[model samples]
Target: MKITREVVQGLYKQTGTARVDTDVAASFQVGDTIQARNINPTGHTRLPRYIRGKKGSIATDNGVFKFADSLAHGAGTQPQHLYSVRFTAQEIWGGEAPAQDSLYIDLWDDYLEPA
Candidate 1:
């Protein structure tokens, strides 16, 4: 089913009704080295398997949004900052990748840590 603007607005409104703090500011800045947390969740997750434990640098702040990990499991939208991270193809693919290529990924705060 197509979710109309009203439906999206309704969901966004509900995001505030739970009394959860979804406005946590981003800790890392653009160009800071970061690594994706090597977590293995059994349920819904947005973290890609290939990027786990890999090192990268922050490219931009994507603002905050409802935490997908919690939202997938019916938990409150524990909002947190999101970012666009840039990783070398070699960092993700090892010797098989070209040095000139890079990959960009949008990740949440909980998924990253200083490298």
Candidate 2:
């Protein structure tokens, strides 16, 4: 299917900021340890390849938002808690990486699990 200007405009009109104002349970919290679930999906995904399987700490709550993968597949919004997770550079790039360096990534509840 070819995408044109009209479809793009319609989508922007339908979905505003993509932030859903609704109450949803947060599976993890700030300072809590979490591991990014490692799954190579054959479809749309928000998780980055480098972040997968890496352990991190929840740095902030980004609140409930529509799930991107689901929405990309024509599924309705699946609002869920989003978090800013902090991972040590060393954890992702091995011991050679500086310990002081850290990377923060915004991840969804479904992409994380207790570490």
Collision pairs in model 2: none
lDDT of each: 0.88, 0.93
Candidate 1, residue 61: Cα displacement in angstroms equals: 0.3
In model 1, where do residues sit more than 4 Å from their true spots?
1-22
- Which ten residues in a row are the worst by lDDT in model 2? 9-18
User: Each model's TM-score, in the order given?
Assistant: 0.79, 0.86
Model 2 clash tally? 0
Q: How would you encode candidate 2's per-residue C-alpha lDDT over 17-109 as one tens digit per residue?
A: 788999999899889999999989888999999999999999999999999988988888889998999999999999999989999999999
Off by more than 4 A, model 2: 1-15
RMSD of each: 5.3, 3.5
Query: Can you give the lDDT of residue 39 in candidate 1?
Result: 97
- Candidate 1 per-residue lDDT over residues 58-77, each given as its tens digit: 99987777888899999977
Residue pairs in collision within model 1: none
